[model samples]
Target: MTLTPNEILALPKVVLHDHLDGGLRPSTLIELAAEIGHELPSTDPDELARIFSDNADAGDLVRYLEAFAHTTAVMQSADNLRRIAREAVVDLAADGVIYAELRYAPEQHVAGGLTLQQVVEAVQDGIEDGVSEALEAGHAIRAAAILDAMRHLDRSLEIAQLALDNRGRCCVAFDIAGPELGFPPAHHREAFQLLRENHMPVTIHAGEADGAASVGEALGLGSARRIGHGVRIHEDIDGFGTDEVSYGVIAQHALDQQIPLECCPTSNVQTGAAPSIADHPMHELRDLGFAVTINTDNRLVSGVTMSSEFGVLVEAGWTKEDLFEATLAAAWGAFLPYDERADLAESVIEGYGIDL
Candidate 1:
């Protein structure tokens, strides 16, 4: 049976690559900005939402990142951070996400005199509160945090250590997110090494602003088990379906190793990584046997949800089976332990009533 948007929303989904700051409610931004005496681009909630969505669609990664300044500006306090984190889970649960890993850079929130550990704790408290509320509301959702270090900065090791410190508490993994062109994952080699040595999970932002070399370094040097926005890995493939069709070293390694690509179609198009959702390489990657998963990299900025992302894939010619496959891939690619990951995958399969 073909799945409608409502059916897709009802399916148990796993989200691995959503940003915490980028997913704030517009009303919350207005309220938080007012409390902090910070000026906003727009006072009306609808206008502010439109501004974020429009600014993020500026045709390149650098411009797309500029939109975060507004969101991160108001997220500078403990209470505001807690409220945003809690609300993010509530929103995801309402949208039918069963599991999620919300990522944010603690360093960005320290401008208001909060330490990195304090910022993490605040977000953790918010996540717990949100989860409890969702359970009480009968949503049955779970969430974990992923600490991000700005790739252009020199604090990756510190962030990695922080993630290690909070392994089973709230933080589940470490990531480096920023402009990927000049700041490749190689610059954070020490941080990645630390996470690797400590047996912590790592997912690098690569192949979004840059090309296949970035993805290669993420997999080889950064030791990323999953690639955030690895859309440009398509650059490593040649002559699709032609007699000359072949995988370059990086693409072959990613495919052979089953490395998951957190493919965000709307965000990819907004950042010009893909021409459009219909033209995204996710379909090709899945067809080529890569472990590809769908996500909303930024719900507010990209104006998308997990269900809407699935709808985009469907409009791009994906069937319910393909959506189910992506959900299962996300469950397996989750940073949870093996048994827990397996259980999540089974739950998703049962939710979809599939035999995968």
Candidate 2:
């Protein structure tokens, strides 16, 4: 059965690819920008929200990423960072997200003279505050940080060290996020190697702006435990919709390994990664034995909540069982211990009211 919007909102969810800088509340954005005299496209919260959504709908990854400058501009201070991080958790919890991994580049937040370590600490403080407040409000949500390093920069090794130092404190994984073209994951092999030696989990943004080869580099070079926005893996398939489907070497490898794909359908459509929700490859990939998990890559920028994302999928022919399987896959793919993952799986199964 197709799930209604309210039912979708009540369903327990897990998000592994959310961006902290891209999910700020519109009112908070205006207020933070005002505090620092930063000019915005619109000062009114509603108008500002529309402006962000419209700007990000440019149908190109480079153009879509232009919206982040404004949000990151206002996030240069510890107070602002903490406030945004807290609100992100509270908002996700209100939307029924039981577990979320909010990611952002610490290097991007140091423009105001804060150290990378300071930025991580501030965000962690906010996450703790958000968790306590959400629990008090009758929502039980657990949030963790995934520190990202921009692929276009030269500080990935340093950022990887930062993530390592903050492990178990707040950071759970390290990632590289930026334009997937021109800059391949191999360029940051040193950083990835450092993370590997430290036994830290890594997720790479690939197969979104680029093609399946980029995904191959993420697995082979970066040793990514999860692929962010891997919708482009369809490029390696010979035929998609018929019994004649055949997977390429890379696609076959991913399927054989069951590596999780953090599929963000709305953001993918906006960035021209997918034509539309009706034609997204998430269901097909899942059917073909790939571990596909749904996520909100950027909530405010994409103008979506977890519930709205699932609602759109249901409209596009996904069933309630589809949501359950995807959510379960997300739990299994989370950067937690096996015992923790099992507990999360149990929570999801209980929430869905299904025997699995």
Candidate 3:
């Protein structure tokens, strides 16, 4: 049966690349800005939402990123961070996301006199409250934290240590997120080394604004088990067709190592990584044996939901079986323990009424 939009929304989903500061509700943004005496482009929630969507659709990575300034500006205080985080979970649950790992840079939230640790704690508390409320509402949802360090900054090691210190408590993994062109994964080698020494999992933002070289550095130098938006790995493929598609070193390595690529369709299109959903490389990558998983990089900024992402893919010629496979891949690629991941995968398979 062809899956309708509502059917897709009702299906259990998994998300790995969502951003905390990038997914604030438009109404919440306006209210927070008012509390902090910050000026916004528009006071009307609908107009504010349009502004965010339009700014992010600029087709330039740098300009697309400018929209975050408004969202992060309102997320400085502990109360604001907590409220945003909690609401993020509630929102995800409503969209049928059973599991998610929301990432945010703690250093960005400390501008209002809050310490790094304080921001983490506040977000964690909010996540707990969100999970509890979702359960009360009969929506089973679970979320974990992934602490990201800005790649252009010098506090990567500090943030890595923070992630390790809170391992198994709130934080699940360490990530480096920011401008990926100039600041390659090698710039944060010390942080990666710290994570490696502590046996912590790491995911790097690569191959979005850059090329396959960035992805190679992420895997080899940074030891990333997963690549955030590794869409540019397409650049490394030698032959496009003719029965023998040759993979370059980076592409071959990613496929051979079974590293997961968190593919955010709408976000990638908005950032010009792909021209549109039809032109996305995820379908090719998946066919080539790369472990590709779907995600919502930013629900509000990209103006998407997990269900909407699935709908786009389906319109682009994907099948219900393809969506099921992507969800299963996300479950296995999650930062959870082996048993937990296995259980989640099993549940997803059952939810899809399919045998693995």
Candidate 4:
């Protein structure tokens, strides 16, 4: 009783934590890179695809991030930004994703003489165009940008203000990304505070390369609403043999606080956060009443989709109940406003109606 990737897609799901530049089509990158005179790992499309897949499987965060150089290099222009954003929406729609909060750092795209406002505007224009194209083609799509501040840099507060400035127009949330260890959320406390005062939502990357202490700082210092790859919370669990005692203070707090963990299974495996999807602690975290949502952290990098991700989960022994709960978890944890979030939730449930 196996199902195809398209079958998993038809189940209706929400993507809470996917990156904009990281999900580009390999062919698109090949063309865009050529247009900008950017140095690519290989000129051939198949070679380029291999480069991305290998980097994602490189087993360390720093090595795994080398592939982004090509994506960011070609994405600095208004035309490129708009095209990629439009393609992003169309791609997500094809994968059966109804709503998405795609994130990228505006600072990175400004290298080509365009200002941050121009960058934001370009992305918004492309998103609008893509959604328009999808509807004309009779497909559903809703997308908003989440401006991420690179953790290794010190411009997060600036990025936070930029996201706040574009709140209703294009930006939906502020996220912190980059090397997760050493650079704890405390480093961006100012940005988090700015987001808090402005009532802007914030999601922090934590508990992936680092440990639970880093996740604790993200929660306590950043006041993170949603945690990216909080898989390391498994470190806090004890009594590994029989009746494993995972009821520690932090574990209990996460369950009671109901913070959603953006569990990107394949990316986690690629980045060495988890050995594999089955070895991922998502099952334990979900069973313990924690909100565990599935995601593709980087589609092109990992060579995955929400569809492929679910198929992998099913092959790893996830049942229909598991799929349903994970889908609902992702939809609920989406950064949408209450009404839109509710609409998405209703849409997911209704998708399961009149079974095939």
Give all candidate RMSDs, comma-separated: 1.3, 1.0, 1.1, 1.9
Ordered list by lDDT, greatest first: 2, 3, 1, 4
Q: Largest lDDT belongs to which candidate?
A: 2
Error of 2 at 303 (Å): 0.5
lDDT of 4 by residue, 1-356 (tens): 66676678777767888898898888889898887777788888778877788878877666678888778888999999999999988888888888888889999999989998899999999999999987787779788888999999999988998998999888988889988878888888899888888889878899998988877787787888889999988776775223657566666677788888999999999988888787788877777678998888888888888888888889988876787777787788888888888888888878756342
Q: In candidate 4, what residue range of length 10 has the lowest lDDT sum?
A: 239-248
Error of 1 at 1 (Å): 5.3
lDDT of each: 0.90, 0.92, 0.91, 0.84
Backbone clashes under 3 angstroms, per model: 0, 0, 0, 0
In candidate 1, list every pair of residues with a backbone clash: none
Model 2 backbone overlap count: 0
Q: How does residue 269 of candidate 1 score in lDDT?
A: 90
TM-score of 2: 0.98
lDDT of 3: 0.91
What digit string (tens of lDDT, one per residue) describes model 3 on residues 1-356? Answer: 67887899889999999999889999999999998888988999999888777878877666677668889998888899989999999999999999999999999998899999999999999999999988898889999999999999999999999999898877999999988889987788889998999999999999998989999999999999999999999889987433578888889999888899999999999987777899799988887878999999988888888999999999988998899988999999999999999999988998889865
Q: Please provide, for model 2 over 1-356, each residue's C-alpha lDDT reduced to its tens digit, 9 standing for 90 to 100.
A: 76777899999999999999999999999998898898988889998888778877866556567669889999999999999999999999999999999999999999999999999999999999999999999999999999999998899999999999999987999999988899998889999999999999999999998999999999888999899999899889999867789999889988888899999999999988888899898878988889999999999888989999999999988888888999999999999999999999999999999876
Give TM-scores for every candidate, taking all chains together and pairing residue i with residue i.
Answer: 0.97, 0.98, 0.98, 0.95
- Give the poorly placed runs of model 1, Cα more than 4 Å off: 60-63, 241-244
RMSD of 4: 1.9
